[model samples]
Target: MATEEKTLVEILEENNLIDLAKYVNYVSASQAGAIATFSGTTRDTFEGKTVVELRYEAYVPMAIRQMKSICSSARSSWDIHSIAVAHRLGTVPVGEMSVFIAVSAVHRADALDACKYLIDELKASVPIWKKEVYSNGEVWKENSEFMDRKLELGKTNGSCCRRNVKVETHGTKSCCGAKVKVADGAAAEISTSDAGTEETI
Candidate 1:
């Protein structure tokens, strides 16, 4: 099976704000009237304690799937021409860019909205987990307090797993109507009846 690879905008090194800005600029070219960017950096404090560094790990395939889904959704919802999202794994120091999201659009509103949505969805859905290595101790914090709050507020939404789902492509009743049923059994059977009343299985 082919697996999706992971990519990081910056390697696990010292913080470089200029590189982040340059990446954003690279993604957002002169064709776009507005460019929206969101950069998440390591914080100096966590849970009222001083923090030093953070180690991030991810299920590479799943993380890539989630990111691609985010980009697809943004493209469908907003009039955006380009989008780039990159998150770092491995050790990240305090005040270093952990994730970067950039979106470009013909107008500012769609770009900004899509950028914010991309970041929020990435935080909530992406499988990248972070271990906060405090100056005192080490603790794995998958989602931050803000993410927890968002979850509590019921703002997180998206599909994170691959499940069988029936998708309607157009508003028209397919210009036709067809029904397919999958029965649950030891050897499940999927029955499909087409609009032409033909059954070939």
Candidate 2:
């Protein structure tokens, strides 16, 4: 007789608050010897600026799809038993939890490594946006991991802005008749004249 495979993958989006314990408990199992978790809390400050709160927005369908992909990727790389991921949208006050991740495996190493990879990949690829509200102003934030992936995609597919342009070490100035500006060695903004749209990458 063959034993059944036990696997759990949950991707959740909540407007209210998130309970970390729920995720930890969900990943716990009899066969799992180790469980690892990550809790992301909103801080009170950023770069010496006082942060009032953080507001998160996501393309719900795409976010969930990407999260599922990430979980599948983790399972392929490690012998993970389960994975639980929860992200809170809307307003999250200072010191409040914004995201939580939990992973379980038969060994400590697999659980720990998979937990880290899940969060990192989620932040890098998920279609989630964060708005940091400071005492004086508010700004949208982007993760470096996402930016790096964008650059990598541009290099690999050669479809940046649907044009084949030379990618500079610092930045690509034009793509599909759009001007791209990379700030501080990171691609920060892209503007297109045809669409009259400006976006932050």
Candidate 3:
């Protein structure tokens, strides 16, 4: 299958609910020995403030492009089968999922690792903005991962990211974690990460 067919990316319209089963089944394949998933839901509170809902907005074309790039990055680091990523727009009430990712591979490790990479990259690089509505008021929010990526980019001048085995990209100007040294038109990537370690990017 082509890349378009292998990877499913969607930005749900307003008032639409993400069908978890649809995504779960999308990555299911006979060759896949493992299917890993991640669901990001809105909680009832943040910093002790009661949250009414989460509002999201994104540049759909750019978001999809970035998501596809992230999926390709995951595949570059691991042996993967298929990837499906979805995010909600408009409003997301507390306890409802706002973002979801599903990845499949031949081994548990590959699927698990790719799933982590997909969500992390989506947060770090995708052109999605969020707002948190509290019972009293609403405030715009920026993901910590997104902020960290900005810091990382400021520290480097090169383009094209390659996340390292440690899940920390060095010498990379890109927001997505990747150890790429772009000097004199040369670049390299660090593939994979320590399974025992938690994701940082």
- What lDDT score goes with residue 151 in model 3? 74
| CA lDDT of each prediction against the hidden true structure | 0.59, 0.65, 0.69
Candidate 2 accuracy as TM-score: 0.72
Model 3 per-residue lDDT tens digits across residues 27-83: 888778799999999999999999878777655555566777898889899999888
lDDT of 1 by residue, 125-160 (tens): 776667666665666564764356456767565232
Ordered by TM-score, highest first, the candidates read: 3, 2, 1
TM-scores of the models, in the given order?
0.64, 0.72, 0.74
- lDDT of candidate 3 at residue 56, scale 0 to 100: 78
- Candidate 1 clash pair list: none
Question: Candidate 3 has which clashing residue pairs, if any?
Answer: 162-178, 162-179, 163-178
Model 2: lDDT to the true structure: 0.65
Model number with the top lDDT: 3
> Candidate 1 — which residues are off by over 4 angstroms?
1-18, 144-201
Native RMSD of candidate 3 (Å): 12.8
